[model samples]
Target: MTSQEIFAQIKKKASFLCVGLDPDPQRIPKHLLKEKDPVLTFNKIIIDHTIDHAVAYKPNLAFYEAMGPAGLETLAKTLEYLPEEVFTIADAKRGDIGNTSRLYAKAFFEQMNFDAITVAPYMGEDSVGPFLAFDGKWVILLALTSNQGSQDFQLIENKEGKPLYASVLEKSKTWGTTENMMYVVGATRGESIAEVRKLVPEHFLLVPGVGAQGGSLEEVAKYGMNNQCGLLVNSSRGILYASAEKDFGEAAKKEALALQTDMAQLLDSYCK
Candidate 1:
């Protein structure tokens, strides 16, 4: 989906929430285990419950990949189940050589039909270019991520004293328009988000680390929001594992509603 379309959904739903469909079979309710495809059942319930509250659904590939061949079927079937208007993201975090990257893009954008895919920028423009070549699909490049390990490389400074992520935001911003590109800015680093805002004010940010990871939603909005409400704050574990019983779906809905309620107020206060 284009940036305008995504923002439109935010306005319609009164939310910029992106529900992360990173399901762990072990953590899902035991009643679901009796089903033939437990993981898929878990995902369906989560999507069904949160659909009204979320604008996007991101399924991290690692969880499905770990399940082997059946896992891929689970992933494909899950995609088929999502509503077309609800944006989908493959949290693959893939980037390689030119040809390899092209294939990765085709797999997620063509075969899987995802609206966006997370990409690592360590391979430079050539690795990322192939993805952007596809019409309407998005490349969510990794920038100032929320992990503690992010300090290892993203914080390193060059001769100009600019951090590596600053360089990523500056240079990568030139490769794609705001409609087709977004940066993955972590919600934990609120001050860092202000720094990112200075670099690319118009681009959307696919922010993680909000609920389960302890990132402040208010802090993210205070510094990261723009005129378009350029943020897709994600909540995975908190919503997905809200309950270990049959009430899981209802619990997930409650958690998502609470976040969306908070987001509605943020949009009112910040989206000028």
Candidate 2:
């Protein structure tokens, strides 16, 4: 999907919510296990329940890769269930040599048909350029992340006294336009998002770490939002595991609605 299309969905839904579909096989509701594909069954229910409030869905690839071929099949089937109006993100965080990146882009963009994929930018422009070569696809490059380990490399000061992540934003912006590129700015980083906004004012940011990670939504909007509401805040464990019973779908819906409601208010407050 194009950035214009994604922003339209955000406006239509009154939300920039991206539900994370990182389901753990062992944690799936016991009732679903009897089905031929429990993970896919659980995912479909989540999609049906939360589709109204969310403009996007992000399925982290590790969860499916852990289960091997069957899990990968289930992941593809889950994509089939999602309506085309909403964006789909493969949280693969893949970056490699140009040749390998081309195949990775093909697997996710052509074969799997995801609208976007998360990519690590450590390998420089060549590793990321192939993904950008695809039409109407996106490369969400990692910048300041939510994890504690982010401080290890992302914060190191360069010779110019700029932090590594700021340097990342500086150089990587030359690679792709706002329509085809975005940065992964962790919500847990708080006001750091404002720094990112200044660097790339119009680019969309795929933000994870809101609900369970304790990143305040209000803080994210106050500093990160542009006139276009440039953010796709994600919640995984908080929504996916909201309930362990048959009411899981309903529970997920409720959780998503609560976030969406909050997001609507934020958009009204900030987008003005």
For residues 1-272, what per-residue lDDT tens digits would candidate 2 score against the true structure?
Answer: 78889889999999999999999988889999999999999999999999999999999999999999988999999999999999999999999999999999999999999999999999999999999999999999999999889999999998988999999999999999998999999988667998899899999999998988879999999999998898999999999999999999999999999999999999999985
- Tens digit of lDDT per residue, candidate 1, span 1-272? 78889999999999999999999988999998989999999999999999999999999999999999999999999999999999899999999999999999999999999999999999999999999998899999999988899999999999999999999999999999998999899988789999999999999999999987879999999999999999999999999999999999999999999999999999999999
lDDT of 2 at 211: 84
Instruction: Name model 2 segments beyond 4 Å from true.
Output: none
TM-score of every model versus the real structure: 0.99, 0.99
- On a 0 to 100 scale, what is the lDDT of residue 188 in model 1? 82
Global local distance difference test of model 2: 0.94
Quality of model 1 by C-alpha lDDT: 0.95
Specify the poorest-scoring 10-residue window by lDDT in model 1. Answer: 181-190
lDDT score of residue 83 within candidate 1: 96
Model 2 clash tally? Answer: 0
